[model samples]
Target: MKACDVCGKKSIIQKSGAHRYGGGWAMRATKKRKVWEPNLHSVKVTHDGVRKTMRLCTKCLRRVKAEMAKKVAKKVEKPAKGLHFCFNKSIQFF
Candidate 1:
């Protein structure tokens, strides 16, 4: 049983309809059944300061990556306290 850790996505059975043609003007419709599997991949994920490997579907993986990127971007946009400087000599010390 293959399933996604993030979204609980699993394999499912699907049916498709097709038309069968016989002698002239005679036709019949039939249902074809097939198994559909989720696009799952093994990925390393960090949660609550612990890193672990998990099986995540593509959609969940994309969401996780986007969230990580947003967090990194927010950190990068902030100015470091040590890098701050003042022009005035007396004020620079405070």
Candidate 2:
């Protein structure tokens, strides 16, 4: 059984339904034809010191994106500490 890399949980259920994607050739059908496909999304997953890719459900991907964004925002908000020493040195040197 395949397992989720982030959550480490095996898929609780088999995913089923129609799937549509961009950036590729598309095939459409009228009432004369019907196509049933599975819902899947591309994900940039990092694991085991390497970045590998796999298909994921939309819900999981969205949550991962939000979490990554939050981490980045927190990192940007915290300021570096070296400026205090630089400022004091400049003031005394002048």
Candidate 3:
């Protein structure tokens, strides 16, 4: 019943086939049932100044981290207020 909060990723049942080797070749194939579970982790995320705990998958976690890093980089790259350069021009009346 564990699922990712961001993408709704959940566990699923997968059907796999097993092959038996007799003489270096597959002799018989057997069907096997297995459970495929998503890697979920409990993480704290802040949204709109509100922090909450959520169950997130690894992919989503990486995406969130990347987004945060991008935001930080953007902030760092911006010029400070009153520190920007401006070009002055003068026009002569004809």
Candidate 4:
């Protein structure tokens, strides 16, 4: 079986946890209220005699866990010059 290139661990089970939508929508509108997310953890797994460990980020290790990381990254990096999106426009919400 192929092993992890970076961690040298075997195939890992991609563990994921809850990620509230728009920070539960309250944070999006009020910007003061804070929604909570749990710590996401990736654990090693051995199934049917196969062994592996899923690679995870530091956020999963400590910070608020989220199921969607890449999508968040993209949204956070949206350029100010990009297409102006009206509030009513159907945005591709992560």
Q: What are the lDDT scores of the predictions, listed in order?
A: 0.82, 0.59, 0.83, 0.48
**Residue-level lDDT tens digits of model 1 in 1-94:** 8999978999999876655454443334456789989999999888899999999999999999999999999888675555546665333422
Worst 10 residues of 1 by lDDT: 20-29
What TM-score do all the candidates reach, one by one?
0.64, 0.42, 0.62, 0.20
- Report residue 40 deviation for candidate 4 (angstroms): 2.6
By lDDT: ranked, best first: 3, 1, 2, 4
Ranking by TM-score: 1, 3, 2, 4
lDDT: which is higher, 3 or 4?
3
Candidate 1 lDDT (Cα, whole model)? Answer: 0.82
lDDT per residue as tens, model 4, 1-92 = 43433344343444334446756654445333333333334666454899877654444433223534655886886555545666789544
lDDT of 2 at 35: 39
The predicted structure with the larger lDDT, 1 or 2, is 1
Weakest ten-residue segment in model 3 by summed lDDT: 85-94
Candidate 2: what lDDT?
Answer: 0.59
Worst 10 residues of 2 by lDDT: 22-31
Per-residue CA lDDT of model 3 for 1-94, tens digit only, reads: 9899999999998876656454543434565789989999999999999999999999999999999999999888664555544465543333
Which tens-of-lDDT digit does each residue in 1-94 have in candidate 2? 5555455445444333333672243343222333333445668788688998976666677788899999899888664544444644662222
